[model samples]
Target: MIGSPITPQGVIERKRGIGKVEVEVKNMQSDKDREEDMDRLSDLPDFVLLHIMKFMSMKHAVQTCVLSKRWKELWKRLTNLALHSSDFADLAHFSKFLSWVLSNRDSSISLHSLDLRRKGCIDHELLDMIMGYAVSHDVQQLAIEVNLNVKFGFKLHPSIFSCKSLTFLKLSIWAVPWMTELPSSLPLPALKSLHLEHVTLTAGEGDCAEPFSTCHVLNTLVLDRCNLHHGAKFLCICNSNLSSLTIGSTTQETPYKFVLSTPNLRSLSVMRDPIHQLSACDLSFLEQVNIDVEAYFNAHFQRTHLALISLLQVLADYVKTMILSSSTLKILNGLSTSGSMITQIPCFVQLKSLKLKMKSSSSISDEGVSRIVEYLLKKCPLAKVDVINCRE
Candidate 1:
């Protein structure tokens, strides 16, 4: 009976004592005093504050003004403004938010990059307004990816082609009017890199002018999933300084054709198109050629394979390194009339290295692989041949 410290009443008394202590601590500070203390604690330096704001979207950063008077104006001075409306309920609301942000942006804006990937279709007027803002701020990089459905037929503003300070530009549109053509003359002298995805390159009405030929300093060009319809000729109008070119998913029946007149082109990668025949003008200066042709197994596949072999025969004489990955290697294995024809691989005499990616069940037996190796050894005695199973 030493004070019965373990009793239930003793436990209740200890709990009451803790509650009273917490109440006393809470009563020492009023709401106004706590808010003032928080305000003083949040007074970050300008550079530190800008860095923090950079992690937030323009809309959320702007909304912080409701937090306090000091934060209300801090977002206005941010040099970088990125507006993304991916979570908005509709395009109208997203557009209204963008309008509000643009209206309140500082006049002495240091904005250098603007990336807008809104989920809904944006009208041309709204796009033009954003482009105008980007130009006024001397934006150096602009990337816009829009999923414009076929029903809407959205078009980009022509004024966007004139941003003089833009060095890198990437544009992807799902559906657009065939009548909407690229600007005939790109005035962006500083544009060095360009990527076009799902863009239609139609020959404009009247004498079609090559829009990209004026990009004298352009060094990289990539075309993916582009539809060159209505007899549009894929021409290399500019890019004399181009060093890398990638052409992927061209229409097989559209007879897509283009010339690579760039004498400095170092690498060329082409992927999966039946139009495998390259004209004399294409890749004349290429030092390395990587061809990944999707073989259509049928009468069409046979014909296409022969055409591609002819193309390889042409490239074998000039290309220092050749890489081939596709079902075409299986077709080549079937080309040997007899085992003695192994010496025919010499057509690629200039090849210093040859990489052949074959499928495990690609109709290429161990014997067939050995035969092809012998043929290659005869043609390029000093060449190194590496075979890899692509399926793995």
Candidate 2:
């Protein structure tokens, strides 16, 4: 009987059982290897994990808590929390979640930055409370964006401005009117950068003072789509350390003037509505200047275009790089000496690089090119020219 069990079919069945055992062994080895790798990752230092977590969004980083017992509490130690809730369907749920996280933050937490943006309406009280918590923790950077159809006022808590560790702040609003005016003097002693978008500064009938008088350490400032009305004269009272500045215009019809005295400014960019005129007092230290002239069908007076040319002429002696676009090129081209009238090209003695942008490629005709070449030769003999079509 033992000799009879050595048939071909019996041998084949024995080999199939051996193959199944080998497959199970290989899978066990793979699972063991994976477990060891996970254990090594869990043993990584807290600081290394925190650095890795910084690259992930707050939601995804928090989800790592479910990875293992060691990771359960590590996400709470992250100092930089950025929560973007653009797809949130319920505003109340979002508000509650924010409140819970902020309230549960540890007292010893040294948060460096906090950014929260939601597409739906946000409760104003919750926003102020969150800002207050950040200030108390000495947050260095804060950014907040909200979307709502209601108009509400915001009061910059004194604690927020007084945080000595704060350096950067950005605020964006949608359809929300800031009913309260920011204090004339912000207490951000260490603040060096500020950005305000879609904000309105409502100065009273006689309030002509500067709004950022206390931001003395500011070196970079950007304002976009902001409305400055009520005879508000924006004056840089003491930005001696300022190196960069950008100002954009909104749809307001009122003509406003900005008085900047940044003696150490190295870069300046200005975009104004064609309807409103702009005049800069002194840009003597400017190394780079960009003047953008937006066309307006109703306000085609071209006074602002002319004023900008005159302003550039004043700064030509100091600027090393210059950029002109839209109506600005047209104005410069109009200074051609073709007619019977005498025309003089404003000379830029120090300009080394010049960039010109036109609305259409055809805008740079033969006459326009010749006039520009002649003007540049007269202004800066060693300058190089670069032409770009914005429409392209």
Model 1 C-alpha RMSD to native = 5.5
Error (Å) of candidate 1 at residue 306 is 5.1
Residue-by-residue lDDT tens digits, candidate 2, 270-335 = 776533344455667788888876555535435554556556656767888988775666555655
Give the best candidate by TM-score. 2
Candidate 1, 1-392: lDDT as tens digits: 46645889888999999999988878776666888888765876767877888888887888888987778788888776777877577899888988888888786866767788876667667777987888888888888777654433345666678878888888876654432345446778888888888776655444333567677788887877766545555544456788887777654354555555666787877777546355555555678878776665565666555556656655666787878763555555666644543233337666788788877656657686666656655667888888877774
Structure candidate 2, residue pairs in collision: none
RMSD (Å) of each candidate, 1 decimal: 5.5, 3.6
Q: Distance from true position, residue 48, model 2, in Å?
A: 1.6
